[model samples]
Structure formats: structure tokens, C-alpha cells
Target: MNAINITSTEILSDSWYTLKKISFEITANDGTKSTQEREAYDRGNGATILLYNRSNKTVVLTRQFRMPTFINGNETGYLIESCAGLLDKDNAEDCIKKETEEETGFRIDKVQKVFEAYMSPGSVTEIVYFFTAEYTNEMKVHEGGGLIEENEHIEVLELPFGKAIDMITTGEIKDGKTIMLLQHALINKLMG
Candidate 1:
């Protein structure tokens, strides 16, 4: 088995939302000698989506414009994602709870963790932990409040589970974290 060890790490930039750094390393696979550096966005406090299942076989999602992708020619950049967020010293359950209320205004009674992944293992070290919450029509969700000042304009949408999967396969839902959740649900037969 090949193993890599970290010799040292240096922070090139730091901010409330992002951190850029470089690292000195050694690869034992074939005595590969090299130095690697990465620019990482702290993205402090990850993100989440509320999958509220309404009657008629539909689940609620959010449509929001992502600036990062917008510049890349993704005109809308509107994403269909599940409820998720960063650990940030807070356990997965707690963080999800907070994001659920903030993003969708739905109070979750129960949560089941689906999966977790590093958003971008190549350059950034952002791990998005995802889960599914069982919500009923009785739940009261207020007018969603997102980071408007941050230029985030979002609209809540309810889509059929099958349609959501189709969106993922068709590349309509492009966010890595959201894809992870949808794939897990599909593979595990949990999207009821």
C-alpha cells in the first residue's frame, strides 16, 4: 500500500470563510519527492437542504444561484439539494437541525444520516455531511430566510422523488453534496 505523510503545513491566507495553505509532503509509494500547495475555502459552517415531502409524491428543495458556478457559465446555477451542512465543531445532527430551520423553516422531528464526502478532495478540504429528515405536511415552514446580504436569493421548490433523481442524472443538480445525498437515497431505496 502506498502512504503519504505530511512534513509540514503553512497557511498562505486566512479569513472568516476561507483558508489557503501549502504543504510539504513525502510519498512513500515510489519515493516521489515534491511539494504540494492548495487554495481552500473555509466555507465555515457548511450548507443544508430541507427535503420536505408534501402530498402527491413530492419533496421540497431549494433553488438558489451559486456565484462560484455562475461565473463558470452556469447561468442559473440553481441547485436541487437535500438538507446538509458542515460539522464546524458541531456534530452532524446538531448542525443539520440548525440548517434545517434556517434554510427551510421546517422543524425536523427525526434525522437519518445518509453519507458524507469531501466536496473537493483535489484542492479544497470541505466535507459536507448529509442526512434525510422525515417531515409531514403538518410542519410549519416560514418564508425561507437565506443570506440575502450575501446575494443569496433562494426559492423553495417541491419536486417528485423520481424527478429529483432524474435531475441528478441529467446534471441538473450539480452540487457534489446534494448528489451524494440523492445517490445514497437511490442506492439504499430510502426515497419513499
Candidate 2:
């Protein structure tokens, strides 16, 4: 294993989240040392969940406009994604539950944490916790469109499980977290 030492960190932006340029030195196993610098966006960690209904073969999702996606060649800028939110002062499970109700109108009491991952390790310092939950129409507490105070205008979508799966291949669903959760559902036969 290579030994790493963080030499310096400079704050680049702190308007919304934090963006820092970090400088470090690595001493390799072969006795070679090198210095490197990289910028990392720290939006903190987050949690995402897929709400599936086995009887109805449906899943709850959200559609929202993402500026990064729009500037990166996504013409429409609207992305279909699993319900997710940053774990501000809450734990992963609590964050997901709050996010699920706020973003998708589903008040899920039980969620099985499937996994956790660094969605973009190269430039972002966010490890997202992934979860899955079963939902029914009775769980819908309100018409979810995200929190207005947060400037989030999410569109709730209840799509057929099979259609959601097909959207991945058709490029209709491109959100990384959403794809991962949907694939998890498919692989685990969650709809059955």
C-alpha cells in the first residue's frame, strides 16, 4: 500500500457546498515519492432509495432538472432518478426516509439498506448509502414535488418496474444512483 500525506487544502468555493483543492504526496511501495493535487467537491454524504411494489410491479421515482447534466450535453436537463438527499444532520436511514416522503410522497417505514458506494470517487467526496423499500398506494401521504424552500421542483413518477428497467437501455434513465438501485431490484427479484 502506498502512504499518502495531505500537504495542503485550499477552499475554492463555499457558496453551496464546499469545493477544495487538495495537495498531497504519496510514497509508493518502491520508495518513490510524488506530489499531486486534485479538487474535490464535498457535498457531504447522501442516501438514495428505490421504492418498489411487488404486487403492482411498479417503482417510485423522481424527475428533476440538473444543471450539471444540462451543461454536460443532456439537452433536456431533466433526469429521472431515485429519491435521494444529503444526510445533513441525520443518519443514512433517517435521511432516506425523509427524502422518500419529501421527494416521492411515499412514507416508508422500513427500508433495507442494500449497499453504499462512492458514486464519483475521482472528483467528489460523497459516499451514498443505497436502500430499497416496499411501497403501496396507501403509503402516499401527499403530492410530492420536493421542498419549495429548497428550490427543488421534483416530479414524482410511478413507473412500471419493467419500463424503468428498459429506460436504462434506452437512455431515458441515466442517473447513476437510480440505475444502480433499479438493477438491484431486478437482480433481487424485488418486484416478485
Compared with the true structure, all predictions reach lDDT values of 0.66, 0.96
After best superposition, candidate 2 residue 9: deviation in angstroms? Answer: 0.8
* Residue 97 error, candidate 1, Å: 1.2
Query: Which runs of model 1 end up more than 4 angstroms from their true locations?
Result: 1-8, 30-33, 44-55, 147-152
**What is residue 103's positional error in candidate 2, in angstroms?**
0.9
Model 1: per-residue Cα lDDT over 1-192, one tens digit each: 545555566666665565666565656567776666556656754645446463455666777766778889888766666655466778778887876766676777687765666667777777666677667766656766555664546676667878888997788888776666666666766655
- Where's the lowest-lDDT run of ten residues in candidate 1? 47-56
Tens digit per residue, CA lDDT, model 2, 37-137:
99999999999999999999999899999999999999999999999999999999999999999998888899999999999999999999999999999
Would you give me the overall lDDT of model 2? 0.96
Candidate 2 to native Cα RMSD, angstroms:
0.6
lDDT of 1 at 55: 44
